[model samples]
Target: MTHVMACIDNSQSSLAVCDYAAWASQRLNAPLTLLHVLDEEKYPAAADLSGNIGLGSREHLLEELATLDAQRARLALEQGQHMLEKARERTVISGAAFPELKQRHGHLVESLSDLQEDIRLLVIGRVGEDNSRNAHSLGSQIEAVVRTIHRPILITATSYKKPEKVMLAFDGSSTAYKTIQMFAASSLCKDLPIHLVTVGADSVSNHEALGKAQSMLLSAGFLVQAEIRQGEVESALHDYQTEHGIDLLVMGAYGHSRIRQFLVGSTTTTMLRTATMPVLLLR
Candidate 1:
């Protein structure tokens, strides 16, 4: 069965990520998997010992360093195990029935790609444990992971708030249209208030597109609101979300349409750094 896979890490957002994943799993009625990856580069087994040690003490020093490396590797393994267990506990507590837990040692992007086919949605923190220090920076693994996989990703904010309403940042692109259609057919957006927002000049073309989308959802018995606003996409959308109590954002990843293009731009990075709610990115 397809699972809502949560990428659990030692970030400040870890608990919130797990909770969001659990909520999503229950809401969608899908199974859950919590994965923790130990990147070798981040937690190296040994420091480089070449040319630094004096020739006389080299043999003894090398053996000592080897022993230390062994210890470090063991500690890292234990730490990762603990992280996964904690994530599983939190997920189950949040209402996931028997979420699967996994610990992997490798590049995170590669591991995600290997399991991409089995994942229906990917949940991750906007900023990871180490990268959380830089508030404005996106998680180091996010770009690479999104670039590698085509699955929808739910990027959690640092704080967990159960979402009551969802906003779709719509732009006139095949990808955005497809995303709207996909959500319209799924239970993920059903029975909840939806805000379909398009930011830019108010043109006939924009109106036609938004109108069709609103009409489609209304026909499907969705409580949908379609709004058009002017100015920059991020700022306008952010203000609207803040004013309207939007708790979840749904949008495409990248496209000629402005929303996804802006998503790949600096604005989305800024949003990730200071996002107040979860964002569901359609790839």
Candidate 2:
């Protein structure tokens, strides 16, 4: 069966990730997979060790470093397993049915991408253990994972709250159209109160596009409210979200260039970074 993959690390947001994942799993009636990756780069306290030792005592120090790396890896492996166990228990308690646990050794993005086909939904936290709370940066691997995986990704906010209302930030791009279609076809957004807010200067095309999207969602049984407004994309969407107390934001990840849309200058990234609620990004 397809699974809702919850990617977690030893971060403040890990619990939130599991909670959201469990909710999705229950919603979709899919299995839950709590995945914790032990990437050396992500866990430098455990990564390979070769460069830092001095030349004169290189060989001996290299041996020591190797031993240390091995020990660190072992500890990390155990820790990751423990984390997965805890997360599994948490998910089960949160109404998930016996989530599968996975402990992996590799880069987070690559590993998840390889398993993307099996993932029906992806759940992750805004920040990770390695990232400082002070910065506005996303978890180091989040952007990369989002770009690589075509499945819907739910990026949790500071905490979890059952979304009372959902907003679709339509931009009238091809990606936006695709996102609306996917959302309409899926039961995930069906029956939910959804607001389709498009940001653009007054134009016939923009109005037509937003109206069409709204119609599609309505056909799928969504209680959709469509509106056209003018402003910068990110700020305008965020403002709408705030004004409406939107609990979830949906949008397309990439741009005109399907393959490179999310690489840069993507409004999806901006919204994901700053959204006060969860972001359900469609690729």
TM-score on alpha carbons, each prediction: 0.92, 0.89
On the 0 to 100 scale, the lDDT of residue 111 in model 1 is: 93
- Which candidate should be chosen as best, given TM-score against the real structure? 1
Candidate 2 lDDT:
0.79
RMSD of each: 2.3, 3.1
lDDT of candidate 1 over 115-163, digit per residue (tens) = 9998998999988888878655678777777778788899998879998
Best by lDDT: 1
Q: Please, what is the whole-model Cα lDDT of each candidate in the order they appear?
A: 0.83, 0.79
Worst 10 residues of 2 by lDDT: 257-266
lDDT of 2 by residue, 85-148 (tens): 9998898899999988887788888888888889999998888778747336677667777768
Q: Identify the runs in model 1 with alpha carbons over 4 angstroms from their true place.
A: 44-57, 134-136, 265-268
Minimal lDDT window, size 10, model 1? 265-274
> How far off is residue 219 in model 2, in Å?
0.9
